[model samples]
Target: MGVPLLAIVAWSGTGKTTLLQQVIPLLKARGIRTGLIKHTHHRMDIDTPGKDSYLLRKAGADQVIVASDQRWALMCETPDKPLGLTELTARMDHSALDLVLVEGFKDEPVAKIALWRRGVKGEVADLLDGYVIALASDKKLAIDYPLLDINHPLSVADFIENWLRTGQ
Candidate 1:
């Protein structure tokens, strides 16, 4: 079976990570194996400086793998090429996850739930443009889509579970 993917999209400071932090454990408690993908505009480093993996990459290794008994991580340096959502998701180990929750990549043409807040501009059009399947907000929004409470992660989790089950 193909891995189910959903994107959680919102403006900065809209608490996307906070909601995911709450929802991930709830999903895990239900025996759901979840995978997460976060997209950032700024540069991020998973390897620390002076570590062996870091040193190897600095010495011109294209890819570096750091493995241990507990876990393994692979870091690939792509200085010239930037990967899109499809390419990035394709690189994931799909067999290991029941669902893939994508945090950001708002323009990737995937199923998404948009977290909205009052005074946040430039995202209302996304809902109207049909890019967002559901709306989660702290304030009441009079729209024709599924509206969810941003404060209640359980309900949001329920919504996500239903979506995964029914493919709606």
Candidate 2:
């Protein structure tokens, strides 16, 4: 079977990352192997300037991989085309993971749980649209979707586990 994918989406400062940090460990405790993909709009460089890898990349190498005992990372310079969610997911090693939790890509066509907090700088009406299977929020709202407590990771994990089992 293909690796199951889900997204935790929200506006800025809604604790998407914080919830993932808790939920991942909880899922692991339940013997679920998880992979993660995070999307960012800002420009970022994993390699430092003046380093050998950076210098080689600056010289126009398309891809650079650095490996050591603890970890290995591959860096590719894509100046023209930014990779979409499908392309990024295709690059992951899916054989070992049961689920892939996407931290961003709110516009991607995937199953998602939207994190909503009161007084945050986003419209709840627009944020709730499209592929949002559930909502985890700090305060109760008058919506018909399944509501989850944003502070409770265990309950959220249970909800995710049920979704995985039933494919709902």
Candidate 3:
């Protein structure tokens, strides 16, 4: 009953991030309030060394919030246990969003649009599951689910807009 979540999933080297970069602006043009959560395997840190927030966090603060007139960010230390998608989603400020787009968590059981590119080592056939509502690819394939042209961001945005309207 909160912001509906949809994932754009693909194997590494696929255009999931690139596609989302284009699609997000298009979605905003259509008045959809969107939020995003991207997952990465590499170790990442947003806090900068010598910054007050960073220094405070390094001094055993479990969480640190840096605020300004323009924006704010919360950095939480959880090295002992990584949070899963559900927990992460719950932490977002849903009051300002209509939808949340997930970049990874491909194995999670969420409704998703799978992406595939020709010669990308993995087959589009293997990406399908009951949770997949659509497939975006560089080439067309015969499939039961909706097919999307990965090269065209407008078409992808159109599909998402329609999906939002229809609650699919």
Candidate 4:
């Protein structure tokens, strides 16, 4: 089995990352070891251009590992299509995490909490898809699932903690 996972999904500019920044610390205070996987559409690289790792990768090395006392990172070249959620999760160290929070991957068929803001573009559309177990919005709305206050990170963290304990 995989580590328990929950996704926080929303349109661009809806504060997915911002809310996570707040909620993660609260979860940590409760002793939840959370791992995260963020999906981006941009072509980006984390290594510096002239760094040895970057140079080696550019020289056609398929994978490279950089290590230090603080941390280590593996950079691998995936020339094919982007990996799906399961494939991506397999790369993570599941034993080290109590929960995995995903940002984006809005279309993936995983348990998710949909976030909404009143004025963001695409606000009119319904996000209550089959996989969305909860909705967090700035304003209240009638919905079958639990509705959380997007502005309050504590409540969000509470809901997550409860879910972790009971699988609700």
My TM-score estimates for the predictions, one after another, are: 0.94, 0.95, 0.96, 0.96
lDDT of 1 by residue, 1-168 (tens): 468789999988888999999999999998889999999988899999998889989999999889999999889888899888887888889988999999998888888999988877756655444667899998887887799999999999999988888876
Q: What does candidate 4's lDDT look like per residue over 67-114, in tens digits?
A: 999999998888886678898899999889999999998888889999
Where does the lowest 10-residue lDDT sum fall in candidate 4?
Answer: 120-129
Better of 2 and 4 by TM-score: 4
Q: lDDT (CA) for every model shown?
A: 0.88, 0.90, 0.92, 0.91
Error of 3 at 39 (Å): 0.3
Q: Which stretches in model 4 have alpha-carbon errors above 4 Å?
A: none
**How many clashing residue pairs are found in candidate 1?**
0
Q: Which scores higher on lDDT, 1 or 3?
A: 3
Prediction 4 global C-alpha lDDT: 0.91
Tens digit per residue, CA lDDT, model 2, 1-168: 568889999999899999999999999999889999998878899899999999999999999999999988889888899888888888889988889999988988899999989888997777776699999998989897899999999889999999988976
Return whichever of 2 and 3 wins on TM-score. Answer: 3
TM-score of 3: 0.96
Candidate 2 overall Cα lDDT vs. reference?
0.90
Clashes of 4: 0
